[model samples]
Target: MKEFLGTLGQTTARAYGEDLIDFSRWFEESDGIELVAGLVTTLDLRDYLSHMLTVRGLKPSTINRRLAAIRAWLQWAKRKGAINDLPVFPRHLSEPKRAPKSLDRVEEARFLRSVAREGNVRDNAAIGLMLYAGLRVSEAVSTKPSDIEIGERKGKVIVRNGKGMKRREVPINADGRGMIGPWLAKANSDYLFPGSVGGHLSPRTIQELIKKYAYQAQLDPNSVTPHVLRHTFATKILRSGVDIVTVAALLGHSRIDTTAIYTQPSWRDLERAVDGREGGNGE
Candidate 1:
């Protein structure tokens, strides 16, 4: 099912595949296991949850994700008359909530300086592309010169296989072109940001570079990442009042809804917005 296939997009899918397959295998082995219809009951769902929690020792987030996948598959099946109903989702099976992450400007500036300090024009461009262009790590890694059109006034980075493997063109300005120029010339390839041997940089290496900066900056390793740098880029751009749609397009989001999450205010921004409200004061 496409629901099962969609998991491939997640970072943990490779590791989680065995567990998911095992779950399917176990379902087939169980008595009265009509895999499609009979298993749509709460009793059946709870029993599976118990198996995952007790036998597999899976986290709530992991369990919930698998459950969500199962639900999607069942929904698809039901629509096609292969099943009757959706399995009731366990209310208690919920992920631990946490705030989204980003870097402050000072820390970001230090990180940028470190990249530039490498004196590898490629490194400079890689970090610059993330920070200035607000690109996802994977997008930065997969960039090709052919995917980009560099001109004097309005340049563009064409993300061919973006988050959902969708393509879109992201317009840029002279500053972006200037930032990318040095790396583009030295590299001989269709790839704008080539990898270590030859291709775009690996996600692991980009992550390692971020770790290196976090250590050098004396900041918590959790506080920094290639994605966070991208978020920082969008955050800075949004704070500067570049519209959300613009940031969404620049971030290569397929939907403006996906990009709106980046516009969540920093504490400082939120406080200012709250304080500046003109609603009547309490007596």
Candidate 2:
């Protein structure tokens, strides 16, 4: 299965294929069914969900994506007549109730400084995009040299296969573009951050790099993941008074509501509200 996924040659496929294999192993271990017979029913789907939730203790979002991959695989198998019955599916919840994690300006600075000392161009660029551009780690690593247009005044990054497979182009200012100089110069291959085998960087390796830098910066490495870098970018921009709509588009979010979740109220916001309440006017 991994070999088949390797043919796809995209990071997203790699993750999905592994998830499918994991699901099959989980089902076999839990239900004693080495062979998933034809025509899976809704019951089987529900049972799998129950196991993931109760036994594995997976969070709602992770569990949902894994189940989705399983369901899609089953549907394809059924079409191929690999299974007689369709696997049963479980009811999906509306959303995960967890808040997204972000870093403050001080922590963000420390993280970037730590990575600068790592002395790996690809690693710095891959992590920098998350901190500056609010890119998902996958999006940053998969970024192609072609997708970036660094300019004197403004720059842009094209992100393919973002959340829900959406594509969006985001503007980068001088600071953000400056961070990529070494990465672009050192990047000889197509991908901005090529893996040991070429193509996109390994997601696992990037996670490890994040952990290492977090420790050096004297921060909680457990809390300092790639997503935290992305969150820091979004929160910093929003608090700096960038409009929510523009932030949403830059983050490749499909909905403004999703972007709204990242918005942080700045000190100025509180001061403004209080000033208005007290009827303060220009002296």
Report, for every candidate in turn, its global Cα lDDT versus the true structure: 0.71, 0.76
Cα lDDT of model 1 by residue, 1-283, tens digit: 4354564656555545545565576677764463544355777678788988998898998887777666656665688777666767777675543324777777776766766666767666677677777778888888986766667776777778788887777766676677777777676785776665876668888788778867777787766888887887788788889998887877877688787776665665555566667443311
Identify the candidate with maximal lDDT.
2
Q: Looking at model 1, report the run of 10 residues with the lowest lDDT sum.
A: 274-283
Q: How accurate is candidate 1 locally (lDDT)?
A: 0.71
Alpha-carbon runs more than 4 Å astray in model 1: 1-99, 151-154, 196-198, 267-283
Per-residue lDDT value at 120 in model 1 = 68
Candidate of highest TM-score: 2
Worst 10 residues of 2 by lDDT: 1-10
